[model samples]
Target: MTNRPLPRSFTHVDTWVFDLDNTLYPHHVNLWQQVDARIRDYVSAYLKVSPEEAFRIQKDYYRRYGTTMRGMMTEHGVKADDFLTYVHAIDHSPLEPNPAMGAAIAELPGRKLILTNGSRDHAREVLARLGIATQFEAVFDIIAAELEPKPALKTYRRFLDLHGVDPARAAMFEDLARNLTVPHDLGMTTVLVVPDGTKSVVREDWELEGRDAAHVDHVTDDLTGFLQRLLPKR
Candidate 1:
């Protein structure tokens, strides 16, 4: 992560939009393993290609297309519903209920929302696994947003407008550094969750040069700890 000065203080905002998936659950759990396997299988089955070729094709398609689902839609004419169902059919046993997280979220001083690049079913499964599904007012996932994923200003703008959120009064909490960039630019306070078990560093090239560093208002290894600091003690 970039070594930058922290914001002096963060006001308790009216709306708090959270990113699902790795943000709700730690990344070290390797939840993506199942998702990746599903993607590979989907490519092989639908494209009628070899496993090796499917793997390569999946990566290539993901690179060219924003998401593997998008690639499937364009190439194999697979319906989005079928794609989401097939990919998210993974065992969610690794994720356990986090009561500490529930308490922290419950103590927060505003409405909370979930914004994710996954399907709503996937987001619901994750939140349900974490035992914090009830804390959010609504979940806006890739399907709800018409397949336009995050890191795009248009998505963020549309999300804000859809929810009647004022960017200046809202804050975004995410685990990915890249995902926080556009939110920061749109005047939302951004917080990056650098979980302690993260294997790789989470800095982007732009952040290293201090170009996108200003957008990130805070970084912490613990989401609950950050919330504890920002909210009153229970």
Candidate 2:
């Protein structure tokens, strides 16, 4: 959290857009670690490469393309469904329900939606584990974006068009600061959800970069606290 005053700019927001995964749940939970490992395994087996080679290729694809799956789809002709299904088949038990966060999200004004690069099934499972499945009106997922991932302008445009969300009246929350860039440029209030720096989490160096960028309007390590502060006191 910054020393600056709370974001009063959010008052005009009529649609609250949240990214799934690390944004909704604390990163310390390590749920994404399982998914990351599964993705590595998939890559190793799919390409018949060694573990080290797989790791290198996986990250290289991720860097070149917004997502590893997207890169595979483009270069190797991998089917999106096959890749998504394999990577997301991980344990969800690590994610316990957050009642306070759920309450805060349910209390937020107007429509609440999930915008995720992961599949809708993955988003639904995560939301179910968080006990906030019913809070969001809809999920705009990678499948909905025709296998394209976030940070892509066209994907964001598809979401806006499909949901009828007016960017000026919407607020977007994401764990990765870069993902908020397009939303901010489109006139939405951008909030960066960062790790609290208390625990180690598996992530790339670039994924942790760009927190102080101009596109980020607000940054918070505590999603629940941040959302709670956005609403008027009871």
Candidate 3:
């Protein structure tokens, strides 16, 4: 992957907020498979639906609610906390500590935070598996943030306010392009992590023309390399 210059807006930031899940780890590992299975089981058991029906309904609910837990809570009357606990109970052994990523994160110049649409327990598990759980100053997960997920401008704003962060000075690194839009609007420098040889599917709502395209400061195949370029030597 090619290295790019850091955006001018990046110089104004003292904190970096990172998205968890697909952002912290590589996507091809299929780490979400276990979680997906748990979600399906929960749906089948609680909703009393057939496994086939549960799978179909779970997919639809995720599409509608932005998360399976959220859909379960709203439509199936499942308790949010219970659903979160159940769905995230999968083993995280697939995630081996990524020394390269851990080193890069260790060398970052400013405070770091994990912003995720999952429960704090899930985030902790992932981070611990990656061997970088102690690096971040704080974690703002769905429950901590009152269940408002990412790509929501309000959630981003609340995160900044809660952390006393200035958007103009902060940078957000995320795997999803759509999640970058809200931070970009809030004056934060946005970096899109496009894993090696991966092509990002343009969402129906994504307007990728002209100035809108410029809102994304950089795109990199690997976040470790991206951080090496953007952050000064520690």
Candidate 4:
């Protein structure tokens, strides 16, 4: 693979979109484990089932509905608001502040937004913990997407409409390659934020596709470095 400067596709980007969780932060922190456990607990309690059963159900819902919240809402009539509030309540302390990432993002000449399947509360806590809370123009959360999770065209379409974003002038960065497909189809340049070491998408994102060559325009392990390179040489 050629080591190139920021491609022409990204040079004029007027809208920068990012996915929270493993995308903004690296995967080694395993902050997701905390949320995963919390979600399992919530599932167990809500379903009045054993932990193992809850785990099985959660995975099924994740595969079929894109999120446990969506599955629960559809089948169990669970309250999306309450579920989001509960699952995102875990301590966000695992994520330390990254002033470097903050600076890189601020240097980008565009509206910066976080498009995530997580709740606004979770996104807020994580961004504040990362010291990049103020760098974003908006955080379009799962709640804002009406509980339609990513990889779904509807959520991306909703984000475009709500933000008045021109996909042709935008670029999207995500940890999961599959999530980038819709954005690619919507005319946004797609970048995959690869995790360190041999790991990539976790088991929870069971529907994640490894087909980066088909939809992704760029791939990088260091998001800070990647963002820095996107800035025009001064």
Candidate 5:
């Protein structure tokens, strides 16, 4: 199989959207694992279930519903704010500052935004750790999306509408390939950020689906390098 050329020019893109967690930072950091544990704890306490049962429920919800929060909200009437607050309260110390990524994002030609299934506070904390908090114009979080997670067409539509973004002139970067489908369908360029092979990273089997699918226009392991490569030579 031949390697396809990455879209060298994003000059046409006016809105640059990025997913918060694994998309912005390397997955090897294990920051998400902390959040995952907190989510399981939350589920266990809220449902009064065993730890093992909560673990199962957490994974099940993620598979059935785009996010565990959404599934819990639909089935158990869980409050999104409470769940979000608890799950995102994990220590962010594992994430190191990336000035290179900040510079790369700062050089991108348009309105930068974070479109995350996570809460705004979580996004802000992660961005601050990445040293790129000031790069984004706004964060469109789960609360703003009314608890609708990514991979949902309605959520993507809402984000586009709320930001007055023209799909044809926008670009989205995310770690999960399935989450890019709606953006691809909406006519935005979709990039999938995969784990760099240097470290042993653990992820659910379902999370690995559609990685090489048609919806992904580009794929990269080093997000900062990829972003820098997209810039016009100075």
Candidate 6:
């Protein structure tokens, strides 16, 4: 948690784009697991499959089609909005307000925005829990991206167009390093937020080396500390 100067390349950044979920709140909260189980249930009940089978297909579809929701839409004709609402219906009580994080975020010098594959409602809930809803200029969610999830080039292009953001002058922060590829290719400095103690999430072989990818600009286990370091001196 050292507070230090950021790389010189970051000095040109004027917009800060962050991913929600594990990027905003620490993964230790296990809130995502609740949504994950709900998705499994939805898939199981819809397809009449066992929960085990549903979970398998859920992950498979998630990997194949960017999101299980997208795969369900493509394969099962599931309604995107409905699926989002169902999956995100879990209790967000595990999350507590993070005023320190909110304060550190306020110290950042740029227009802030959240880019997520989640629904706006869920994003609102989480941000409210973190007590930082007003800090963001906007949230670009799945519906906002026309249901196109992240890691998808078109979604990134659409978001950039809609926000009038200059890729070269913006920075993208995400928990998944792979999600940073498009942003990095689009000329944004990418930071991977892998907060301490959540390393076990890299279950897949590819995920194992994501932080080593060329598109990954930096890795930090402490996001607030990272932001604090990047803040300009008063």
The TM-scores, one per candidate, come to 0.85, 0.95, 0.84, 0.92, 0.95, 0.93
Q: In model 4, where is the ten-residue run with the lowest total lDDT? A: 203-212
Q: Candidate 3 local accuracy as lDDT?
A: 0.78
* lDDT tens per residue, model 3, 100-176: 88777877778899999888989999999999988899999998777767767778888988988888888888876
Q: lDDT for model 6, please.
A: 0.87
Question: Clashing pairs in model 4?
Answer: none
Q: Candidate 4, residues 192-226: lDDT per residue as tens digits?
A: 88776665545444334453466788888899999
> Once superposed on the true structure, which residue ranges of model 4 sit more than 4 Å away at CA?
1-8, 198-211
* lDDT-best of 2 and 5: 2
Clashing pairs in 2: none
Better of 2 and 4 by lDDT: 2
Top model by TM-score, which number? 2
Question: Evaluated with lDDT, which candidate comes out highest?
Answer: 2
- State the TM-score for model 2: 0.95
Q: Estimate every model's Cα lDDT from 0 to 1.
A: 0.79, 0.91, 0.78, 0.87, 0.90, 0.87
CA displacement after TM-score superposition, residue 32 of candidate 6 (Å)? 0.6
TM-score of candidate 3 against the unseen true structure:
0.84
Please state the error at residue 20 of candidate 4 in Å: 0.5
Q: Which residues of candidate 3, in runs, are more than 4 Å off?
A: 1-9, 198-215
For TM-score, candidate 1 versus 4, the one ahead is: 4
lDDT tens digits by residue: candidate 6, 12-119: 999999999888988667688899999999999999999999999999998888889999999999998789889999899989998878888888878999999999
